[model samples]
Target: MAEKIPAGGTDHPGRGDWPVIPDEREADLIGLDLLDHADGPDLVLFLAGNQFMAVPELLEAFRAAHPKVRRIFCETLPPRLELRQILSGGAWFRGRLVTVVPDCWATVSEAGVAALAEAGRTERGQCRAYLRNRVVCLVRAGNPKGVAEVADLARADVVVSQPSPVHEDIAEHILAMYRAAGGEALAARIMEEKREAGTTLLTTVHHRETPERLLAGTADAGPVWATEAAHAAALGLPLEAVEFGEGLDQRGRVRYFLCPVRGGAHPENGRAFMDFVRSPEGRAIYAKYGFLPV
Candidate 1:
């Protein structure tokens, strides 16, 4: 007898009883066509975000569950940019099945959630939350620099590298926290020094690339999600994390969400994948990656 396929299997076109949206616009927008076309051993799932490493165990489990799904197309862009691509419909080529992980603290605000809901209204499908992640700062191993606290970051000898505050929402939050902690004078002094000495003390890069630079010692410190930092440490990289003395704000800890592009071809599959992510097994994967379940 042939191997028994799972009940919700995607191996056969119609075996899983997957909801098939007839309208091509909805199907195409959600990436149903790509799923149909790439029905063999190489199904492509495009994921864009900053915390890729935080969920290795979860990914391994996902692979174990769905062996046919191969080739995860990923981009390490900042969440803000990812949001822009979704809003502008820039990912039409990658099939309508675009899955975006927005910065948990930055993009899941009341206004942000409202905006996403509006966007979904225009599209045929919808958006939903997948997981939550904690943002933390990564420092050199052993913190030999004595940069033990966020306030120490304002010291002259310290070089802080972060993503652009304007486009990188998490960076903006850190900046806000710094200002709240009375780092404004320090920021002004840094600006003055830059104007007088033409020295750039602060550096910001796209979110995905921040970790690589931190591991390479290109920067003394950078902001990163807790799980990403954990993964880096697991890799034996010379990195350590400094959680805020007061801890993350109550609301900040529960902000990450996964949004499915509207009018895409793979709403049903998208929903299924999301369901798997929310399942007990999926939660375990997320926890292993340092993300809290939603």
Candidate 2:
């Protein structure tokens, strides 16, 4: 059977005991393109998948600061895929269904932000750093895999789950970390050899599926953002974080960037949201969820 993508932070309320969106059912409708029964969202945010845990608190602050803005739509997915959807104005859902375009966008790397600007998707000047994070290995509680470091992922006995480099910017960092820890041969072993042997499973949505793979015993460990692992533990999920050695894991180096989409449907709202994400109050909310704010 093929692996299923978990419902994601969209359905469940997160670690802060706050819902990313006010209503799961309503968010589901929008995600599924099933309902046009209500007014369109005031602000639509396209964000990196790893930041899902902070959405509820971020949205709460956005609402408190801008009370007039009521229906906000936030979509979190891999940055590369999200950028493609943004450039094309929409994304194909189940069987060619198109979802609505978002007003603003945020990515785990500045590369996506730069690409958007270069491609004329978003204004270059408006893009800025929003938050920070680092790579970490998420494992089953108590570290049953004995994955003490990045190199351990290369062991024959370990089965690892990794995100697709085609869609996730984090994949690049993970690969670089692997190369730093061992060498290109080791990187190839895990990225190619082990993958061909079914020992390193590739995930479509890293943030949402990695934890599930760990819980299901299908994946012994996976590289993910430190904040994501923290969020999982905070929610009482059976997962533990394994910090990697400096210079190898790229710890204290990852920076997330955000921008207002050019020619967006709600340019004003996009600007407001861009500002809100950088606001002191907004940074505090993200910090509460383990995200390192700018």
Q: lDDT per model, in order? A: 0.51, 0.75
Off by more than 4 A, model 1: 1-48, 54-60, 63-76, 91-112, 120-127, 183-205, 248-254
Question: What is the lDDT, from 0 to 100, of the residue 189 in candidate 2?
Answer: 93
- For model 2, what is the C-alpha lDDT against the true structure? 0.75
Listed per model in order, the count of residue pairs whose N, CA or C atoms clash below 3 Å is: 17, 0
Q: Which ten residues in a row have the lowest lDDT in candidate 1?
A: 19-28
For candidate 1, the lDDT comes to 0.51
lDDT of 1 at 264: 44
RMSD of each: 11.6, 8.3
What C-alpha lDDT, on a 0 to 100 scale, does residue 164 get in candidate 1? 60
